[model samples]
Target chain A: MKITFAYWGNYTIAFISLFQKLGINVIPPEKTNQQSIIEGAKISPEMYCFPLKANIGNYLTAIKKGADTVFMVTSLSGSCRLRYYGIIQDKVLSEAGYKVNFVILNQNFIDIYQKLKKISGASFWQIVKAVYFFFKKLHLIEKLEKKAQYLRPREKIKGQTDQILRETFPQLEKVRNLRELTKLKREIKKKISEIEIDSKKNVPRIGIIGEIFTVTDGAINFGIEEKLGKQDIEVHREMDVTYHLKKIICPWKDWQIQKKINPYLKSTVGGHGRDAIFEMLNYTKNNFDGIIHLLPFGCMPEVVIRPILEKIHQETGIPFLSLSLDEQVAEAGINTRLEAFVDVVKNHYNNKNH
Target chain B: MKCYLGIDVGSVSTNLVLIDKENNVLFSLYIRTEGDPISAIKKGLKLLKEKIPENAEVVGVGTTGSARQLAGVITGADLIKNEITAHARGVAHFIPDVKTIIEIGGQDSKIIILENGVVVDFGLNLLCAAGTGSFLDAQSFRLKIPIQEFGKLALSSKQPTIISSRCTVFAESDMIHKQQIGHKTEDIVAGLCQGLARNFLANIAKGKNIKPPIVFEGGVSENLGMRKAFEEALKEKVIIPKYNTVMGAFGAALLVKEMSPQKSKFFGFGVIDKDIKCTSFQCKGCPNQCEVIEARIDGKVMARWGDRCGKWSNLNMNNI
Candidate 1:
């Protein structure tokens, strides 16, 4: 079966490698753009979350490119609307007269393996190796991204880190084995480190915590991470595809997040609501200058947690900027808010020092 | 006779203020932007030259507001700050103990929370125009009431009517419906003020710790009715500083005074006569398609910005 999945930053590369290793035909969704969002929103319900619309758009674009089967990661139980996205997306697609099969995977490892076995006819050991390769690449990409975040704000030349990262992603795709991957990792690290960065520049450090999709998707968030980096603010984002996968594979992380956020939030609000609070608290304790919470318009979990985050801000005296984004959100509006926010944080820092 | 110049180029109005070494306002001018910020700054500078003392020399310059970058480039400002910081600085200079600042301008409204003369938090209206000064101005025009008399009419009402300020369209329709019901004009005006104040409090000041010693500044603060509405809504007295309309410009001037940069980037008031031109084009280098803006002075490119990749911006750096 020809399969396709939505893009989540560079995570698509790992997915392609895994599917290729299993000898399955995988059609990656077209790069997200204004056309994709417009197409996705045209058929989607008005109040559905942005990720759903974008994901549906991706599937439609993939289908147009000849993908007959779609793969989606779903949850069985959650207050977040994400769990219901699979059924709604399937219904929406079929109603649009597209005949396609959808393979939905939950947190169950055995269930995913069984589905893959039926689809790809791959040996159990080969499937395991593919999964191993997927994770290894994911970890490597995450490391590279973290390094870029550190270097972007301090780079003597603007956009140098971005330029290096843009070139590194394709190079990562060509790696075949552990030895090759390690060598490439070192080479990319050296290349990124070689980018000249001003050592004396004292930049305000910002931590971004929010919904997974909006946090990872640059197009949707208006490239906020890059915008902050361009403003010479060191932005550290904790949510990524690999981080989400790790939490899914190991449920103990959720327990720890729950415990840390227990005093503020009594129960899970579902999705990343609990996790957002945990991450904000973590950043606050670590002496980060500011916390930016990004959520899609009408996201229930995030909406529920916003006030709590504000309360944390009041209690800690650390500035918190909550940006709710929709397709209608203007780039100028975002830029102005970010500029004002950066000013507030910098002024606060300067005042504290004096 | 050394002076520091501050220019605030907002969407609705462009304000310029000049201050001396003692931070006393030497001269101030407020003019309608009319959608042309460069021309507005030039006109303001011309007026400044005519009004200021003959011997006064501009030693430092600062720019603030939405068009700060454009103004900074044209004026060669020593510092370019956002309206939030500028407004807060301007007010904190006058009211050092202010804990909250409610600034409602023509196109946007913001709430800045301060502590001990430092900004701790701020919120700006996003994609909403209901609680801003332009909305009130538009309503005044629709009602055939002079904009200057709007506040007086609102204050005279004994019982304000209830108007829905959730959206501008809804509020206009609601006002018409109230008028049809034979409600007095003053009552409707007061109700609109209350609705706007409520909207500002609900959205911009939502979940904010608005304490005492709140200073309200901006063009909208000139309306006593809106100030009363805010007072009634927050159940706390709000102080409107003397220079409410030009607070942003005043703040910018104060910030530059505080910094007192060793080398001022002021290009002098002669920039008012220079032939400055700005052009924009979309860059096709990547998918972002950033609209690169270029500013030219006397037909020579001085600055290029708005590119996401910094490709064009780097080129302008060499020119500088």
Candidate 2:
């Protein structure tokens, strides 16, 4: 059965490989862009959060390219909001007239054993091997992505990180042994460390804080981090696999961190939006030149976060910017804003130097 | 001789609570935000300065809320907390036996489930504004009644109508339909409160077990109408703390009192009254229209923020 599966971002590469090992055709959503977001948003409910629209866009884009199935994973316990996204997305896609099949993989429905049986249709031994192989590659990719973060900051050449990522991700699919995966990780780490970082000039140190999906995933956020990289600006974003892992284990840490930092401005659970506001304030007090806050459009946490951020910027005498992305985000507009910010930073740098 | 100050600066209100060396609130003030948090905070500080004795030395200051960071910077807070921890702390402190906390503030509502003083599971309603104080404010405006009087009006109802509260627009239209049907104003007001309560339960409380001693707090805690509605919906009695309105601030203040300060980096009281000017520009950083805002005090840049990239976050400090 030419069962083709599609997923959203770089993390899914390992997921794709496991299915591929089981003789399944796996495809990553084509590099996401502004048009895709708009196209997806046009079909999605206007009130749905931004990541929902972007994911819908990814699936729609895949289905349009002849991919039959899309996968959505969920958590059964913490944060019901995230759990509902998969079901909602399925209904939303069906409403949009895309009759493609959705393979929902949530902790609520399928256990680890059942998932292995359903997806691979293999005996216990075969399933164990496949699972083991998948984790080996998964661990490698996770390490690579982390190392990539450190390396990404070093690369002076524009799109060097992008080019390297594109080449390295696909090579993971060919890994049949643990040694190959281990070798791949070590080489990638070494190469990444060698990438030169231009740290002589002082750059603004901005911190990003927001919802997990929209913040880390580039397609939903419209290539925000990459764009910042081009401006030769050091970006200090905390959203990644590590943060998501933390959310799963120590769910209240997000709030605890908020509690730790926010008392200076507001004393209440302001939500993630409030956390972002505090982070921005921290950045400002620490002498960060600017802070960027991003969320999916109509996102509830950000709604609370936005006004406070506006208030924080107003009160503390700090430079802050906000972007809300749904499927309809325009890349050109985003790029324009980035260029203006870079120009402003450059102007400040020039002024300071003279 | 040493005292502490805790401030909770929210979108709709700014709260200040002065804790004595013993963690007791000596003087507390709650001010309506009125679309200007800085002004509200400044006014809060001014009120704090006047109310407290100068000899009661402020040993530590804590800040929390949506505006905690800005508040921390302004107040020189020694400790800061998110509203959840602060609110949870407030509930745990006042009502030691409390199991669940239902907090409906100006812009959002949350249900914190606690088991023996530790938070087990919690739910926050982020998508809908059906249960928030702002929603009640809008409903009050539509009904041509003061927001403070909404609970009183609901209490007077004999036969309450059931208004659809799935969406605010739908709820408004349903309310108008009920009015046309000649339902008593008090009944309709009661229905509005019930609708908000139902909406909140349906959205955030699906399948979650909510037990007592339930503490209802935040700005909306003052609404007897909503409180009654919650009781009817949950079929259990809800408790409201004495200083319910500023619980998050109080909780945050309590947190600061509990924790030893690393150091007081507070900018001092003089900074609160400064003529700070804030300006924003659309960041042309990539295709993201990040509105980078800059804060200036006395014609010098005091801080810069509002960009996704740290492109300009912490680079300049010529005493700015």
Candidate 3:
């Protein structure tokens, strides 16, 4: 079978290596940025959810490049209205005059191997090689992201961490061996630390929680991390769609590194607020100055967690700013909150020092 | 000698279950909610106190369902669990090989997917009212038939019509049209069941891969007609457990029993009859104006919640 892999952002290198190992065509989406988010939301359903619009936008761009198939990971349980994402997007795309086949990879679904067989038309050894490479790329990306987080607040100039990350990402795509990948990981980490951060200034550490994809990807949050970076505040984010899906596939053992952060806080097994509640307590106990919980509009799980988190803030006296993103994720609105939050955290530290 | 108490407080029904250390069911009580959760809980507690053995010391108490928090504070619950975990645990305990759970309760419906005793994927509908038990109850009321008899009535039908199941209003209007066309009540009831089944399939069951050995429970599980409709739609037999109605309560009790018995954080049985008052105030901390609800017991704040950011209620340390 002739297959074309479609994805958003810079994940093209990872998919290229994975799909190439299987003798399949790996197609990259248009480079994602702030403009793509606005354009995507405008073209798609106004209320379909954030991840959906961005993903749909990305895939639509890739399909324009003659890509015939889109691969999306769907989790079995969680507040990610993302379970029905592939089917919904598939239908919506068809309605909008795009003819493309969508391959949904969900842990809950049985016969995944057979489904892959149907999509790839690859030999047994070839499929195994592709999967092995895919997982390897995943591990590399995770390592790179972890190092990226530690660098963001510490950088001398705002966007330095992002600049270093952007430069280092392409170098990772060239690596072929596990030893090479390990060295690259160490290099990223060391490079991140070398960027001068104020050692004497004890800035308040704030966490951003809620909605796996939107929190991690800068396109959805509109570079809020960079805004916080300018204020010398270390921002910790704990949601990743890749980690959520990997955890489902490997329940017996840890599949992602962040699991070590809080092993007890699992995904909402019932599609509820348990993850938020557990994370809230963990963030509070860790003595973080505040938390910024982000969620999509009409998210049921976050709706339930709102009261619990409000209670957490009440108990811990932690300043929390909750932002619910939908289609109208304007740059001005985002920057206003980011600037105010940083100011509040700055004032908090200043008062504590006195 | 160990005793376990399980309570499920839902929007429409309150259920209580008593199980011994061996997990043997000793007593079960299910009652209507009537909008006042506190009153329903009081009635349930009174019935439980009267029915259970006086000397049987309740070693552990567990609460589940939508009102699990409120029930936990009032009943001194040792464990508070969500409906999904409770249902999955209860089903796994009773039938180890259970793979799927289709629970349709009052005001809500859920689909639980389990692989090797752990929940892999689950879906619930709290937004829509089309496929839930309350939808069936309202339809039954509109048809002037008791809910229990509606299932049997549906089974007697020969031909069932395909009515609009997207919205409740559309379904009711379609049902009225079918009635005017001289259709049999049994057939119309059967058609309604099919409509609900179709709605569940289109909405909650979309993109879900349903496996066999499915267990159907909750208030709507009593509807044999709906069970047949689902079986026919999926081309697989639906399995209904012995104590399907109280599965959430049973699941909660089982979870509590799994833990080492501890002093329950329960407020005691006196809380059942006590005049509990609830008041709300708009928080002026910011522009959000989050309405914080405070529950007072004997003029003391026992529990406070309902804020969007926890600025107001998180300050109350007396209850914690």
- By lDDT, the best candidate is 1
Summing lDDT over every window of 10 consecutive residues in candidate 1 chain B, give the lowest-scoring window.
B311-320
Off by over 4 Å in 3: A1-354, B308-320
Q: Give the alpha carbon lDDT tens digit for every residue of A1-354 in model 2.
A: 223433455666666666766656666575455556777778877877667666777777677768777667665453425567777888987887877677666543236558657766777777677667876776676665555544455577655665576668777767666788889877776666666666464554445667666676765666666777656666766666545555555758766766755544454333355456556766767766566778777677676656667666556534455666665455544553454455434444444456
Model 1 pairs in collision: none
DockQ of 2: 0.01
Off by over 4 Å in 2: A1-142, A146-354, B281-293, B304-311, B314-320
DockQ of 1: 0.54
Among the numbered candidates, top DockQ falls to 1
Candidate 3 is graded, for docking, as: incorrect
**Which candidate do you rate higher for lDDT, 1 or 3?**
1
- DockQ of each model vs. true complex: 0.54, 0.01, 0.01
Q: Worst 10-residue stretch by lDDT in candidate 2 chain B?
A: B118-127
Worst ten in a row by lDDT for model 3 chain B: B305-314
lDDT of 1 at B75: 85
Each prediction's whole-model lDDT (CA): 0.88, 0.70, 0.73
